[model samples]
Target chain A: MLLLAVKGITESNRKFLSQYDVTVVTPDTITAQQIPEIVISYAWDDAIGQKILANPNSKLKWIQTQSAGVDYLPLKKLKDFGVVVTNASGLKAIPIAQTVLSYILYFARGLNIYASRTHWEPYTNQYLVTELPVLVFGTGRIGQQIASHIRAFGGTVYGVNTTGHMVDGFDEVYSMHDYQKALAKSRVVVDGLPGTPETDDFFNNHFFDQVNQLFLFINIGRGTTLNQNDLLAAIDDSRVKYAALDVTTPEPLPKNHPLFDRPQVLLTQHTSWGEYVNAGRTGGLFRLFEKNVPSFVKSGTIQYNIVNLDKGY
Target chain B: MLLLAVKGITESNRKFLSQYDVTVVTPDTITAQQIPEIVISYAWDDAIGQKILANPNSKLKWIQTQSAGVDYLPLKKLKDFGVVVTNASGLKAIPIAQTVLSYILYFARGLNIYASRTHWEPYTNQYLVTELPVLVFGTGRIGQQIASHIRAFGGTVYGVNTTGHMVDGFDEVYSMHDYQKALAKSRVVVDGLPGTPETDDFFNNHFFDQVNQLFLFINIGRGTTLNQNDLLAAIDDSRVKYAALDVTTPEPLPKNHPLFDRPQVLLTQHTSWGEYVNAGRTGGLFRLFEKNVPSFVKSGTIQYNIVNLDKGY
Candidate 1:
C-alpha cells in the first residue's frame, strides 16, 4: 500500500492509480501508524510533514516531492535509513522561468507603476529585457531554464555556482567566491539556489548592498536562503527597488504579515510552478509521481533527481 | 533642409544629424509659411501634422512618420504629390512584442487576479505561455516577432495574413478568409494588423462572437481598427474576459472613460513602444532618418520602409 499525501487528487487520478493500493493522507489525519507505508510525500511542505518524516519508518523507501527544492526534508536522517528522495524539478522550470520574466517585466516594462495609475503617468526610464543583466543563483535544471528564458527575451544571464564551471545558456558563470562580481553587473538578481547550510540567509544586507542597478529581487528558490529583514532594509535604502517572492520563510505567511501590505513586494504565496492549460496544480505533481513509481517498483532504487543527503536539496 | 517634428531632440541626436540642415517645428508653432518651406516632414502625427501634409508644399520630397502604422495619414495625396513616405516600423516590434507577452504572462501567471487580491487568493487555472495557442493577426515584422517571442515561451502561434504563406516561428498559418478557424483554437488573440480602409472597425461584435474562448484581446497596433462598442459588447456577453490595449481611439482617452475604471482592461495608454536602455524612442527614428537622409541627398529618393499608397499601412 502506498501513502499519498497530495491533496485534491481528482477521480481521474485515482483511476490512473487503479493499479496501486493508495491511501490518501492530509495534514490533519496523517499519523505515525501510517508513516511506514508513506512511500510518497507528494506536495508535503507543512509542519505536520515534519512528524511524518521524524517517525522512524524503515519501510519508507522513497519520498517523492512535488517541490523542486527538497530542503525542508530531513535528508540526512532519511539517508541513514536508506530512504531515497526525488523531486519535481524539470516540470517547474517553465512556470518558474515565466514567473521570473514576469517580475523583470513588472519593473522593466513599468507595469508596477502603470498597474496602479488611474491616469497617464508614463515613466521615461523603461528597458528591453534583452538589455538588462540577470543573475541566477543555481546552474541546475531550474537555473538553466530560467537563463534560457531570459536569453530568449534578450537579457544577459549570469549564473553563480559552487565551482563556476561553464554552464549552458548563461552569458557568464561566477564561482562561489567571485559571485559578488557577477552580482554587480546585474540589474536583476534571481534566487534559484536550493536550500543548504551554505545557502541559508546568504541574501542578507551585505548581499543586497553589493548589488548594482538593483531593480528587482526574485526568489523562486527556497525562501530560507533569503533574509526578509535584510531584504526590507535593502529596499528601504534603495539598494533593492522591489521584490517578487514566490516562496517565503513561513509557508502561508501569517495573514497579518507586513509583506502582504507592502506594495513593492509581490507575495505570490509560492504558486509559481503551477497548473498547465485547464489542468489543476496536481496535474504536474501527479505526472511526477507516475514517472517515478515504475522505476521504484522495478529496481527498488531511485535513479533520477535523487537528492544528495549532505546538500539537503 | 529637413523638417524635424519630433519633440525631445537631445544634443546627442543633433550630433547624429550634424550633416543635415534641420528645422524643428512643434505642432502648435508650425505655420503655413513654415509648411511651404518644409522639404521633409519627419515624425509627423497630429491634427496640425495633417494640415502640414494637406497644405500643398512644392518643396516636400519625403514624409517620415515615427509610427508603425501609416493608416492615419492621407497616403494617396502624399503619393500624388510625388513624395516618398517612410515609417519607424522595425523599431517598435521588440517593445510591442514585449508588451503583448506581458499581457499573456499577466493572465497566465495569475498576476491579473493576484494584483487585485487584497489577501492571498492564488488561482489554480493559470498556464505556461508555451502551453497555449496564440492567434496573431498580421504577419509583418511586429507579428513575426510576437510569434517568435511566444514560441520561445513554449506556446503555439497561429498566424493570419492576406495570403497566409508559411511564416517562420508560427506553428500554423491561416488565410485571412480562414482566420476564424484558427481563432477558435486560441485563448489569446493578438492584433498586430495595421489599420487600412479595408480593415477599419474590423474587430466588431461579429469578430468577438466567433471567438471560442476569448481570454484576452491584445492590441499593440492601431486603435482605429478595433470597434470599442463591439469590444465592450463582447466583454458584457462574457465572450472576452480581458483586454490589454496599448493603443485606443482618440488617445489620451478622456479621463472619465469607463476603460480606466474597468479592472479587466490594461490600458497602457499608448506607452507600449517605449524607452530603450540608453537609446530613447527616437533612436530607431533617428537611425531611419539617418539612413534615408544620405540616400535622399544623393538620389532624391527615400528607399526603405516607404509605405505603399494603396495599402495605407
Candidate 2:
C-alpha cells in the first residue's frame, strides 16, 4: 500500500509509520503517476486531490485530515468519489475548549480592557463565569469539552444542536428551534457549529436579536458561519457587549476593516488548533492517525471521527 | 448600637441593617464625638480607626472589612486594643479566581500577543492550561477557589501555606519550606499570599532562582510580598516566561515604569475584587457584613472570617 504523508509528521511519527509495510511519500517527492491509496493532510491540496480523483487508475481510498473542521475540502466531490473521510475531531477539542474559555475569561475578567493599560487603571465592569449562564451551539466533541470546562467554573451550560437530546456535559440541551429560550438566559453565547450550507450566515441580525441581555459572543467554529456585518451591528446596538472571534470571515480580515478598529472585538487569527501541532513528539493528531491507520490497513475503514460527507460535518 | 458604615453600602443594604435597630453613619455624617461600637469599611480610614482606638470612652468593639486581605489595617494596634477584626475573605474568591484564570489563559492562549495584532498573524506558541501544573501560594479561600477552577480544567494544583496541611481543592499541599519541589515541576506559579513582615520580599531573587523551568507568574496577592526587581531579572533571563500582576508595590504603577513597557508582563491594576462591588443590591460584601452583624450584636466575637492578627492573614 502507498501513503502520501504531508509535511509536519514528526521524526518519531515517521519512524512509527515505517513498520506499517507501506510506502510513504512526501509532497515534494511524489510525481503525478505516484497517486497514493491514502493521504494524510492538513490544508487540503485541491490541485493534487483533483488530479487523484480525475485519474481513472487512481487508488485514493481514504483521506485523513489533520484538522477538526474539514470545511475547506471539496466535500461533495469526495462523497461522490466514495473516498472515506476521517477528521482529527476530538484531537483539537481540549486546546480549542481551553481557548474558548480563554476568550470568555478575557472579557468576563476585563482583560479586554485591562491588558492594554500602561498605567494602573482599575476597571469595575468585570464579571465571573459563575454569574453568567453560557449557551453553546453544536453539542459535538468540541462543544461538549467547552460545556464541561464551563460547568467546572460553576457556570450553567446550555448545549444546542439539531436535536434537543441531552449531552453529558451540558446542564440542558436545546434544539436549533428552541435555543433562543437559552439565549434569553445566557450572558455568554459560543458558536461551535461546523461550517455547512445550513450554518452559513446562521448568526446574523435575526440570531443576535433573540438575545435578551447584553452578551459576550465567541466564535471558534467556522468563519463562513458568521455574518461579519451583522456582528458589527450587534456590537453597535449594544446587543453584543463584546466579541472574541478566533475565526472571522475572509481571515486575514483586511487591516482597514471596521472590525479591527472596534475596541469591543478581539481577533485571534484562527490559531486555536495551533497549540498541539508541535507540542511534543506524540501530539493528539499523530496519536489519532496512529489509531485510525491500523483499522484502515486491516479493513479499509476508520474506527473514529468518520465525517458524514452528505451532512457536511 | 451605632455602626459606622462607610461609602458603598447600597440603599437596600442600609434598609436591611436598619431593621436591626442599628444607626448607620456615613463618613461625612460621623463626627469625632459619635465613635460607633462597630465599623464596616473597605479601605481602612487610619484617622477614624486611630481616633476610635485612642479614645478610652469610645465604643469601637469590632471592625468589618470588605476585603479578603486586611494587611492594610494596623493589625498590631487592633490586637492590642482587643477589638475583633473580621474580613470579607471568601466574598471575592469567585471573581478573583476567575481573574487569575483569566491571567493564566491570557498568556497560555497567546492573547498577550494576538490581542494587539491589527492584521491576521496566527501565533503558534499557544498552550493549554491542562498541560501545566500550577503552584499557588496561600491555600486559603482564594487559593482553594483557584485550585478548584484549575482542577476543573484538568490541570494539577499544588497549594502552599504556612503548614503542609491538606486542602480540599489542591492535588497536593506544601509548607513554605517544601514548596520548592512543587515549584520545580510547575510551569505556572501564583502568589495569593498575604502581606506581612514574614511575607514581605518573600518572592525575591532567592525564590525565583529555585524554579527549574520557564514559567508564567501571577500575583493576585498583596504587592509588598513580591520583589519587583527580582521578577524583572527572572523575566530578563527567560526563567519567567510571562507575568500578570494584579497588585504592585506602589500602584498606580507609573506610566513610565519598565514594567509597563515589558510585552511579557500584563498589569491588571487591582480590580479583581471590584466585580461584585456594584453588581447588585445584594453583593457578597454586604452579605458578609449582614452575616457578621447579627453575631456581633449578640456577642462581642464574629462568626466568620476572624483575622489572626499575629499571623497577619
Candidate 3:
C-alpha cells in the first residue's frame, strides 16, 4: 500500500485517488511510527513535514512537490536517499503569465497613471505593444510562458539563460554573462530565476545600471535573487519607472514598509501561485499527480518535471 | 490664402501649415469678415466655428474635422451648403484600443482588486485573456481595431453592428437588434458606439440586465450613448463586476461624484482619444491634413473618411 500525505483531502480528491490501493494521511492524524510506511509525500515546508522526512527508516521512494521551486526542501537528503523529486512547475505557467502581462499592459497603456488622476489631462506616454522590448531573466518554464504571452500580444521578448540557448516565443536569447547587451534595448525587465545560493543578490546595482532606459521591473520568482536596497535606489534614480513585486525580500513585509507606500511600486502579496476558486492550485497539483502517479506505481519513478537535484529548481 | 482655425497652434505647427500658404486662425482671432474668403475650416465646437459655419456668404468647400464623431456639428447645414466633411477617425484607434485592452487585462489578471488590497490575501478571480469572451458594440473603425487587438492577445470577440455584417478579428457578429444573444456569452462588453440620436442612452437598464454573469463594461465611445443611472444601478445590483470609462456625461465630472469614489469603477477622464507624447493628436491631425490637402488641391473633393451627413458618424 502506498502511503500518501496531503492537506484538506476532500471526497472528490479521494474519488480521484481511488484507482490505486493508497491510504491518505494528514498532519493531524499522522505519527512518527507511520514514517517508515510513507512511500510518497505530496506536501512540504511544514514542521510536521520536516519531522516526517527526517525519519531514518522512511520508505519515500519518490516525492511530488506541489510548488514550482524546491530550494527550501531537503534536496541533499532526498538525493542521498535515492528518492526522485518532481515539481508541479508548468501548471501555474499561464496564470503567472497573465499576471506578468497585466503589469506590462498597465504601464504601456498608461493605466498606471490614468487610474489615479482626477482631471481630463490625457497621458502622452502611451505606446503600442509592438513598440516596446522586454527582457526576461531565466528562460525556464515560467519565463518561456511569459514570453509566449508577450509574443501573442505583439510584443518583443529577449530571454536570458545560462548558455544563451534558443527557446520558443523569444525573439532573441543571451547568456547571463552577456545579458547586459540585451538589457540596453529592453523597456521592461522580468525576473523569473529560482532561488539558489549562486543566484542570491544577482540583481545588484551593477545589474540595474545596465538598463539604459526607463523600465518597469516585474519580479515573480524567488526574492533572494534581488537586492531590495538597490531596487529602491534604482527607483529613486529614475532608471526604473515602476515595479510590481509579487515576491519581496521578506514575506509579509512589515506594515510600515516603504515599498507599500510608493506610487511607483505595486505589492501583490505573493499570491500569484495560489487561487481560492476553480480549484486553481489544487487542480494543478492533481494534474501533476495524474501524470506521475501511474509512472511511480509501475517503475518507482516519475517522468514529468523532475527537478535536478544539483540545480535545486 | 486658406483660413484655418485651431487651438494652441505651435510654431512647429505653423511651419507645417506654411508649406501651403495657409493663414491659421483660432476662435479668439477669427471674425465674420473673413468667412466669405475662407475655403476650409479645421476646428470645431467653439463660438467662432459656429459663426463661420453659419456664415451665409461662407465660401467653405470642405471642412477637415479634428474629431471622430460629426454628430455634434451642423451636418444638415453643411450638407445644404455642399461642403464635404472629413473626420480624423483612424488616428486614435490604437490608443483607444490600448485603453480597452488595459481594462480587459486589468480584470483578467485581477489587478483591479490586487492593487487595492491592504493585506496579503491575494484575489482568485483571475483568468487568462484567451479564455474570456468579449462582445463589442458598434463594429466601426475603433471597434474593429479593438477587436483585432483582443484577438492578437488570444481572446475571442463577438461584434455587434447595425447589420451584423461579418468583420475581421471577431469570431462572430451580432446585429444591434440581436445584441442580447452576444451579451449572454460575453465576459466583457465593450461599447464603441458613436453618439447619435438613435444611440443615446441605448445601453440602459434593459441592456445591463441581459448580462447573466458578472462582467466588465468598457465605454471608450461617446458618453452620451450610456445612461449613468442604470450603470450605477447595475453596479449596485452586483451584475456588473467592474467598469472603466474614458468618457462621461459632463466634460469634467464633479469633484465629489459617487463614480469617482466607487471601488469598482475606474474613470480615465476622457484621455483615451488623446496622447501626451509623439505629438499624438496633433500628429494625427497633420497626417489627415496632408492627405486631404493634396486631394482637395487636385479636385474639389476629399478622399478619406468623409462623414455621411445622414448617418452622422
Among the numbered candidates, top TM-score falls to 2
TM-score of each: 0.89, 0.92, 0.91
Q: Say which candidate scores most in DockQ.
A: 2
lDDT of 2 by residue, B198-313 (tens): 89999999998887445689999999999999999999888788989999979877768999888898888888765643553226666776777776666655788888999877
Q: Write the per-residue lDDT of candidate 1 for residues A1-313, one digit (tens) a residue.
A: 5655656677777666656555566656766577656766666655655665666754667677767778767777777877777777787787778887877787777777767778765564677887678989999888998899888888799999999899989999998778988877788889887888999998988787786448889999888899999898788778888899988888877776777777888877778876565355445667767766666666675677777777776
Stretches > 4 Å off in candidate 3: A7-23, A117-123, A274-281, B1-34, B43-45, B274-280
* Candidate 3 lDDT, B30-95, residue by residue in tens: 665775677777766456657766667778777777778877788888888888888878987877
Which scores better on DockQ, 1 or 3?
1
How far out, in Å, is residue A64 in model 1? 1.4
Candidates, ranked, lDDT: 2, 3, 1
lDDT of 3 by residue, A1-313 (tens): 5556674556766666667766777667777677668777776635755675677777877777777888778888888888888887887887787788788878777787876765556566776666678899989888988888778667799999989999988999999898877888888899898888888899889888876545689899889999988988889888888998888978878776878777888777776654334534556576666677766776666778888998898
- How much is the lDDT of residue A15 in candidate 2? 74
Question: In terms of TM-score, which candidate is stronger, 1 or 2?
Answer: 2
Model 1 chain A scores worst on lDDT over the 10 consecutive residues at A275-284
Q: Quick one: RMSD of model 1?
A: 3.5
- Candidate 1 vs candidate 2: the DockQ winner is 2
lDDT of each: 0.77, 0.81, 0.78
